[model samples]
Target: MKHDDYDNLNEGTRSRIRAKRRKTNLILNSLIVVVILLIGIVSFNIFFSNDEGAADQNGVVAEKDQDAASRDKKEDSKDAGKKEDSQESGKKEADESESEEEADEESAEEEELSDPIVTEGGSDANVKQTIENPEWKPVGTTQSGEHTTVFDQNAVDWQEMILAYSYATGIDKDNMTVWFNGNGGAPNTAVGTISEKGSDQTFRVWIEWVDGEGWKPVKVEELIQNDQKQS
Candidate 1:
């Protein structure tokens, strides 16, 4: 209805609208600040959690490596000990083997030097006769002025013959005279003389008899006379 009344109404409406816009802008700014703060907090938590997990994993790996190293050391020690034991065992076995070989050699030497008169076929009675009576008579004679005797056929070993002659003659084997007859007259036969009282007593004794050559005396008087001079 009038100009003055219309102007007052327009001014009041403009003031109310300006106040409402300012309040809306303040509320929107506050919400944006809250959202930014929440995002920053969440990012910090995630980063710290990842760092801690990495550190734990590194510790676990270190522990596993240490365990492996310890186990390796133990295995190495065990191998070294086993090797030492094996070497000791080998040395002991070698020593025992050497000792056994030495014993065997000694036994063989003893057998070689054993008396041949104690053979299976010969009697101990004959050996006793030669030992008790030193001047036993011979059974044969020869052309060379030598005494001879035919030892038992079964007791024909030359070593036994030497022992029997030594016992019967009472002559030391070391000091007795000996000669090897290589004429192939008889097996294990020797033509020699046993020296007594600085005189030689010749004899041709057959250890094993030959064909067409029976028991004979080579020189009975010469041998007995030498024995008497020594006595």
Candidate 2:
């Protein structure tokens, strides 16, 4: 072949080869860029999804805690209410007990006033007559009108002497009085007697005086004081 024709053929082949290499390089660069984009998208989706799931879990836990707290508060309120009710019930019971005690005291006083067993005489009739008779003067005071007087053998019956003695000594039948008539020559001297009437015309009597809070019966052997010297 001629020299010029050969040179032209070589130049055409070099140009075609350079164009093919440029196309192959461009295709490879495009594939690498697409791979990097896909990786970035997948990473971003994974991170956001994990964050959302964590938030959901936290919200659920918080809600559960609130519910538990509310339940506990309700239970505590109920307990407080129950305690208040119990206290009220206890107060009511105490009040009732106090009222019952007062009633019992009143009843005891009434019983003491009404139940008449016996007094300083052999029978109820004798005591009643002695108290009723204005002439049945007690020994101690000149003024009559239920005043106390000593027992005088001449002034009163021997069996009903305690009635006269009680009047003279100012001793109440319900309450005991002290015996100041033990010494000689004292005025209006004689301890009182308590008596009760039994069936079949029989009678029981006790001569007693006050010592502290108790009533002590006097013995028959005890002597009667005489006020003649004082008079």
Candidate 3:
């Protein structure tokens, strides 16, 4: 070919080579800027791993709603401590049924003041209105042998012819201290002695007391005298 023609061809060739290189360099503009920075680092790691898995699913739904509000505040404090222990066990069984109804009304007032006097055969008891005619006083005068024991002291028990000879001889004396041997006496202690001095000499009286179930007897002071006219 001609010299100029050859030279022109060579120059063209070089230009083409340069152009190719430049094209390759922009090769995908750096592969499209590294595929757009690997798609922006995989979309910021998939949006930071979906915001840390949605904050761990909202912290497990707020720890299961604070454990269901602490198990409903411990079941409302165990049902308010079992309703205050069932209202203190129903007020301790209503104060033990009002102290057993005031101890059965004091045992029915001690069985309505006991004793009613009834000699067996269908039973009945007597005396004990606090020992019949209690309250006695005067306490003096004593001359044993020829009999002259004018003394008295009571609280409630034997007296008045030893409580009528312990109830007309059904004798069962307990806690005693009496002396009778004169001035018109009689109540069947096997014929309570004292052969006569009546119409004024008066008589019958001897008593005492200490009780809790000990010492007892009383009744006198009403024109007293006792000088044993022995019977």
Candidate 4:
């Protein structure tokens, strides 16, 4: 409209038009502000929700890691326990093997020793029984090289003869009384007559010396009486 026409219009009409425009502008401004506020609230809620979701996901991941670690620890402990048990079992087996080896050695030693042979018949009336052992070995000798028979009381041969007599008759030195110790009829041979300390049981032992070996008992005759005993 021209300014002349607007000036020709009544005041009431102009006032109403201005008031309508003012009301419309006020409503539009208020709607815009409300829409902006709603948008801001939605954005805030979305941001907070996203942050909370991320936190929950991280927490789940952390929980899974902890569970995995715990399982690994338990498995390691089980493995360690099995290793210890295996070691203990191995130790027990080794001990059993050692015990078996020891038992075998002891059995072998027992098999090496043999019993003597006892029989009847003697050359004299005083001789009752005879004894011999094929398994008997020399008691060993300290003297080497050439050997000479010594008849002295303090001779080494005499002491060794007594040992042979005791070995053949099963009579110890502490319980036996020597009746006679002298040369036998053959070369490199000796004879000894002995009796128990408090009994009439007597024995005559014949021993021979080998070139390299010591005195070894050849025969033992058990006597019926202590006829060779002195005093």
Candidate 5:
């Protein structure tokens, strides 16, 4: 029966004990709050650091990939430019070749144009060079060799004979005269009858006076103004 007298303490002592307990409880609560706030701040910092590192890594990878794509595009552009340049050079060479071919064709055309045209000699006027008269042939000559006797049996060929004689000697036969009588005029002789080609017999002669020359009792072949000069 030795009981403690704690319940019988005075009011002031009891009040002092209660105040001590309350003060201890308040200090413990404030310490717990400060610990909890520090933990939250540390966790948030860890999460932000990790997220920032991952984002920076992704950004670096993206930049590298973009650089690679840019390089590839540049190479492709260079290749395209080279292809265009080659095509342009080839086109120029082809154009030059075509121009040369055209020039050659034009030169050939000009050469063809410069040629001369010729025709056949079917209607040539140089077919016959002699007359169709037999009286142009000399039958005899005088003893003095001054006169030649030209005779034709057919007097119808007298015109051709005169033309032939004029052509042969370059003389004007129109100035000459002929007579059948021996006593008709000067320089008339009694020559024999002319019998040629079984034609009609006739006695005819001529006399002509040529300039710069003596009187010609026979045929004078050509004149100065004619193209029948003796070669």
Candidate 6:
């Protein structure tokens, strides 16, 4: 309490009291140091734990973003593949349609052809039969524009005329002999006398020029003799 009272105490009691105070102070200081160390350990654990948790959270977020991007890429690839497939399919269908159209055109062209007509000839001359074909098409020509009847043996028109005669009379060109080729009764018309080389199968073939088509045989008369043959 009072310094005068403590100083008036006995020497042995003063010495014991002073020693007790020193021990109590030392124990208090040691307890304070232990409390400080405990506080530091707790703070360090809390800070590090929070940092690890944040890192784990960031990692989860990053993983989710990567997964989303991968999914988007897959979707885009699928869309591109689908677009390519659609284009290829359309092209295939167009090609098939064009091919079908071409086939139809070819079939239509083939349907236009028909057989020839054969009938008995008049008794006016040595005629066997009359041959006519309504579906007869002119032989194709290399010539263009206005047509003129050519009678020269080396002319293209003359060669075509002989071809028409062979076509109408059903005679092979190699086995037939052309006796005459001259102008008929009308313009753009010609008559030819042809006979089988080694036989008496003679015919008078009448042919006419048709614009774009070459020589078209209009009539064919099977003759018993080549009346136009030169002596």
Q: In order, what lDDT does every prediction score?
A: 0.50, 0.48, 0.48, 0.85, 0.47, 0.86
Better of 1 and 5 by TM-score: 5
Which stretch of 10 consecutive residues in model 4 shows the poorest summed lDDT? 108-117
Clashing pairs in 5: 169-221, 169-222, 170-221, 170-222, 170-223, 171-221, 171-222, 171-223
By TM-score, the best candidate is 4
Across 51-162, the per-residue lDDT of candidate 1 in tens digits comes to 9999999999999999999999999999999999999999999999999999999787655533223222112221211112222333232223332433343432333445
TM-score per candidate, chains pooled: 0.39, 0.44, 0.41, 0.53, 0.42, 0.50
lDDT comparison, 3 vs 6, better candidate = 6
**Residue 119, candidate 6: how far off, in angstroms?**
1.7
lDDT for 195 in candidate 4 is: 80
Each candidate structure's count of clashing pairs = 10, 9, 6, 0, 8, 0
lDDT of 4 by residue, 8-74 (tens): 6767688899999999999999999999999999999999999999999999999999999999999
Candidate 1: where are CA atoms >4 Å away? 1-16, 98-231
lDDT of 2 by residue, 43-157 (tens): 9999999999999999999999999999999999999999999999999999999999999998986655344333243233333212222222223322334323334445432
After superposition, which runs of candidate 3 have C-alpha atoms over 4 Å from their true positions?
A: 27-31, 36-42, 45-53, 67-71, 76-80, 105-231
Residue range 4-87, candidate 3, lDDT tens digits: 999999999999999999999899699999999999999999999999999999999999999999999999999999999999
Residue-level lDDT of model 5, residues 1-231, one tens digit each, is 223465556666888998998998899999899999999999999999999999999999999999999999999999999999999999999999999999999898766534423222211232112112222333222134344333453442334344433333334556433322122133322221112223232223233323323223342211112111122
lDDT of 4 at 216: 92
Candidate 2 segments exceeding 4 Å error: 2-5, 109-231
Runs of candidate 6 with Cα error greater than 4 angstroms are 1-114
Give the C-alpha miss distance for residue 55 in model 1, angstroms. 1.9
Task: At residue 32, give the lDDT of candidate 5.
Answer: 91
Error of 5 at 131 (Å): 34
Which lDDT tens digits does candidate 6 get at residues 1-231? Answer: 788777767676978888999899899999999999999999999999999999999999999999999999999999999999999999999999999999998787655543567888733477888888887778778888999999999998998888888777768888888888899889999998888888877788889999988999998888866667644
**Window of ten residues with lowest summed lDDT in model 2:** 195-204
Off by over 4 Å in 4: 1-114
**Candidate 1 C-alpha error for residue 201, in Å:** 35
* Model 1 CA lDDT for position 10: 83
**Pairs of colliding residues, candidate 2:** 138-149, 139-149, 139-150, 140-149, 140-150, 148-167, 148-168, 149-167, 149-168
lDDT-based ranking: 6, 4, 1, 2, 3, 5
